[model samples]
Every structure is written in C-alpha cells, then in structure tokens.
Target: MGALGKENKDLTGVAIGISVLINVIGTFFFPRLLMVSGKEYGPAIIYGDYKNIWVYILSPILGAVSARILYKFLEVTKPAKPEPWHCNICNHNHLPFF
Candidate 1:
C-alpha cells in the first residue's frame, strides 16, 4: 500500500484544475501579445479620458527604465539567438515557418 492516496489524480480533475489555473492566470496576470495587450489596456483612450493620456507616453519610458534596472539588479539570463535553421526533410536552409 502507498503512504497516501493524494498522489493519484483523475484525468478530468487534473484537466479542470489546469483549465481553472490557465483562466485565472489569463484573467489577472498574463498580458496578451503586443497589439492586443495595448488595445486591451487602452481604456483611457477608448473611454475618452484624455486627461489620463499621459499613460501612453509615460508607460514605455518607465517600463524600459524599470526593465533595465531589474535586469541589472537581478542578472537575468538572456536566451541565445537561434542559429539559421536548416530543414532536413524539406532539404532547404530557409527560415522556419516561412
């Protein structure tokens, strides 16, 4: 016998848990891709709140500065650039998905 029954999880329960987790993250934490995220965060412009329009100008500058500061402070690792891809089956050296 095992020490506990907690290790076993049914497929449906695991799927549901993952679905809830993804939805929660997407709702609260995850920002969508570039243009979509910009549009989603554009309530000030969308709602005619021109008073707060400075957000469009300031956010990029502030975000860049904060990112640089965090990069220097945390010593974040950057991924290496991928080398030019050469497909074996296609017998071509062209870019992937192009």
Candidate 2:
C-alpha cells in the first residue's frame, strides 16, 4: 500500500510538471503567433486597452459556452452502468456500511 501510494504521488508530480511545461511553452508561442499575424487586438488583450473591449468581453463568454458544451458531451458519452462493489468475505455484490 505504501509503494502504491508513492507511485501514485510520483505519477501526480509528473503530470503537474508536464502541465506547467506545456503552459509555459504556450505562453511564449501563442503571443508571438498572434503578433506575427498582424492582429492589433492580440497585444491589446494582455495590455488592456479600450479598443479591446470586445475581445475581453467575448473571450470569457465563448470559453464558458465551449466548456459547458464539452462537459455535456462528456457526460452524455460516459458509460451508463457502473461496476458494483463486492464483499470479499461473502463474495457477493453489496454495499458496505462504515
């Protein structure tokens, strides 16, 4: 059990490290890509200018809508039936009382 716990902790740490690395890479690349595209609205977004009101307003709205759609899609696609818990002593499917 201790070994399993250590393995789980290591796995979690690796996942977090990978996530941070990806975010850092995206942070550097996404802005440069926007700048290269000659989109004036891009820099104005982080810098906060009056001209980028639409960008600021619409970004969260679109993000929320997309997130909701994705959540619903995942919920619908998930398996309908869940595996039942089994009692080891009796070898029967049943719920355990704590």
Candidate 3:
C-alpha cells in the first residue's frame, strides 16, 4: 500500500543513508594491523588501494537496491494476512533475508 505517500521516500532514503553511514563509521574501527599466529603481523587494510573506498561507499546502496527488488518480488509489503489465530508465517520460506 502506498499509504505512506511522501513519507515513504523520506523514511526509506534516511534509513539507507543511516545504514551506509554506520558502515563507513565501522570502517574506521577496522584493525590497522593483523597478527598472524600470534607471532607474525601484517597490514590489515588489504590492497591499500584508495579506489577500494568505492566498494565501501557503494556496497550498501547496491545491497539496499537488491534487497528492495527482492522484497518487491517476494511481495513482502503486501503479505497474506491471515486470522490472528491461524497466522503462521515462517522465516524459512524467506531464505537469505537481507
């Protein structure tokens, strides 16, 4: 249902933005170095390529888009509403959710 109207876009956009922001913030918490076998060590930031930044920036957007497409295809927004006593929607049917 488009009952949300204009609020839908605003809410969804902010949600996507917030998720991406959290991912970016988490990137900073990544260990700068990796300890191997508790003896040897190496750089944790793999490849050390600035271009890899795009992967971090774009992955959330891509994932969100894919999830939206999947949800629409699965008709999650317009689910089959059964009687309260008979409702039994199983998560197993929706494999790999997000």
Candidate 4:
C-alpha cells in the first residue's frame, strides 16, 4: 500500500497514456496559450509566469491520479497469499513471517 511493490507494464502504460490525455485536454481548454511568449509549447511553459500556473500545477495532479488508478487496478488483480511461516499453536501466519 505504501510504495506499490510492482506493477505490470500494461498498467503503467495505461497510466501514462491517461496522464498525457488529461494534459492534452487541459492544454486545449485551459489558458496555457495566453502565457506563450515565444518558442514551442515546452519552452513557453517554462518561460511564462502566471499566478495561477494551471498546467504546471495540474499535470502532477493528473499524473498522481493516474498512478493512483493504476495502483488500485493492480491491487484488484494482485494475487493473495498466506504468510510463509505458519504458527504451530494457532495455525495462523504473521503478515511478514518470511
């Protein structure tokens, strides 16, 4: 739950794709163009200074949301297993028995 042990490649790709899609949509809708001084999109983003800073601020939020979705999906598909060491008395196993 803390660090997401391991995620499948497909799941990671999906998350990245979703993040890109969200950012692209935001670009079309948000006021990113207004901040464009000169050069391409990437340079313009770094160059301009906006009080709100929607794109720079919101991209991370989208990425985080995508990552969270991917994590939840992995959790749903992940296999459940018993702990390696079994208790002799009660026939129970500690979570980190291994």
Top-lDDT structure, candidate number:
4
CA-lDDT, candidates in order: 0.55, 0.55, 0.50, 0.60
**In every candidate, how many clashes are there?**
0, 0, 0, 0
Question: Which ranges of candidate 2 are over 4 A from the true structure?
Answer: 1-26, 32-48, 76-98
Ranking by lDDT: 4, 2, 1, 3
Please write out the lDDT profile of model 3 over residues 16-98, one tens digit for every residue: 68766766676588543221212111222454545435544565579769878864664424345543333247523332323
Q: Which candidate is the best by TM-score?
A: 4
* Root-mean-square deviation of every model: 18.0, 10.5, 16.4, 7.7
Per-residue error for 15 in candidate 2, Å, reads: 13
How close to the true structure is residue 69 of candidate 2, measured as C-alpha lDDT?
85
Give the distance in Å from residue 14's predicted Cα in candidate 4 to where it truly belongs: 0.7
lDDT of 3 at 15: 62
lDDT of prediction 1: 0.55
Candidate 4's residue-wise lDDT over 19-96, tens digit each?
567667766886453333233445546877455555555756785797679677657456678656777888986566
Model 1 residue runs over 4 Å out of place are: 1-49, 76-98
The TM-score, computed over Cα atoms with residue i paired to residue i, of candidate 3 is 0.30
Off by over 4 Å in 4: 1-7, 31-50, 54-66, 69-74, 81-98
lDDT of 3: 0.50
